[model samples]
Target chain A: MLILHCPYCGVYAEETELHAGGEAHLKRATIGDSDEAFEEYLFMRENKKGVHLERWRHANGCGKWFLCARDTATLEVYGTYPAQTTEPPADIVAAITAKHPGWSWKEKA
Target chain B: MSNAVSALNGQEAKGDVTVRELGLTGMITLRGDFEDENFGAALSQITGAGVPDVRHFVQAGDFTVLWMSPDELLVILPYEKAAETVAAFDAALKGTHFLAVNVSDARALISISGDFANEVLAKLSPVDMSADRFTAGMVRRTRLAQVAAAFWMLPDGSYNLMCFRSVADYAFGLLSTSAKAGKVGAI
Candidate 1:
């Protein structure tokens, strides 16, 4: 029973009240993109066991989609942010870096 | 007009608590920038209640303003006044980026009252129904069993709940069943 905070509604919603949207910050492959690129965009995902970023919808509460960063093994939530943001906020990134040094998403240090 | 009917036609059930269907209540869905001066003034002028803070509601005379989300509000009033209220919004907020529509017929209202009203609701919702955590003036939008619903505590310790009209019978049944299951004795 994972409890996550909804950044939009400011409510700590249980997993039952939310819908998981898998990976976060996905860049869709356009029409002219290569088949491999399109396949990577559609199917490939990071199977990180430590820090992970994911999308979640507060389906039963505010009905807003948001992003979450958490540890897959320890279930320690890094933070939650609005979906409109392109990347995790500086404070959230700093928090993640503090706990897991040299950690980066998509090779962006 | 006269032919309009409520979802359950004013049905009610009795148990440890009373679950009564409040027939034909008026509701309006309003979405806009809460920070806009015109938005706040127009809402206060029409509803006679200030814009409520997050997760809260304010009542004045026959009107209640509920904060549904960051940019949405639910205005509850007498059923007969819905159309006029919507027109009033158009008149007051002519150039503002706002939306106010009559939703009176699309939803159903229910009231659960008695000593164990909170206990009855606690069985279905994931919200903290404890008196200290959820008190008067606060509104919570949550799932009631399998359906989406919103509820708030009244001044007299009762709760007024609302859900889509299509599930009125189901909501009534759920409420009554929870009321009959007896109290949990733990807050």
Candidate 2:
């Protein structure tokens, strides 16, 4: 039973109450950008076993979209934030760093 | 919406629970900024109750305005007044980014009373159904029996559960089966 905390509804919803949306916070590459950039935007998505960020929707609950930081292999959820945020909140990143040391994500030192 | 008998219309299968399909009750889905100066007052005018905050409801007579989300609410009114309520809201807020839709015909409401109503709902949903966690006037938008539904708990301990009209049969079946199963150990 995978449980996710929906920031909007303020409820820890089970997987049945949620729909998993794949990657989060990807910059769109449109016309005038190089083919490589467009391909990277459309085709290249992360399938990480360590720390990762993804989109999720509380479809059966409040029907709001949110973001989740989790470890894919261990299924240990670090935290969840609203989807409108352009980046993961600081505390979430810090929690992921403290648990899984030497993790690599975008723009994280 | 439809006054047709629900799938579980007359079936009372050995339990203290009394499940009845409520007649066509009016419903509207209203979306607006509660922070807007004219929003709450206009909603109160239509529903005859003070505007409720998110995850709660304000009761007025038999009508209740339930807060569905930060910017959305469900207005429960008389069946004949569903369209009238939406029209009134549209006329009231003529220049706001709001959506007032009449959903009376698109949803189904059923009531389950007696001692087992709480337990039956708890079995089907992830919400905390205890009296302390879900008190009166608290409206929760949660899943009921594998379908999306909203629960409005009244002060008398009865519950009015609403779901999409298309899933009325499924909702009724799940509720009846769960109600009966709670009565005895066997199916």
Local distance difference test, each candidate: 0.92, 0.82
Error of 1 at B48 (Å): 1.0
- Candidate 1 pairs with clashing backbones: none
Per residue, candidate 2 scores C-alpha lDDT tens digits across B12-130 of 43467777678678889999888987897887776788768668888898688888877788888888787778899999989988999988878888888878688888888888787
lDDT of 1 by residue, A1-109 (tens): 7999988778899987899999999889998999988988999998889899999999988788999999999999999999999888998999999999987887842
Lowest lDDT 10-mer window, candidate 1 chain B?
A: B1-10
Which candidate leads the pack in lDDT? 1
What are the DockQ scores of the candidates, in order?
A: 0.73, 0.66
Q: Which stretches of candidate 1 lie over 4 Å from their true place?
A: A28-40
Q: What is the TM-score of chain A in candidate 2?
A: 0.92
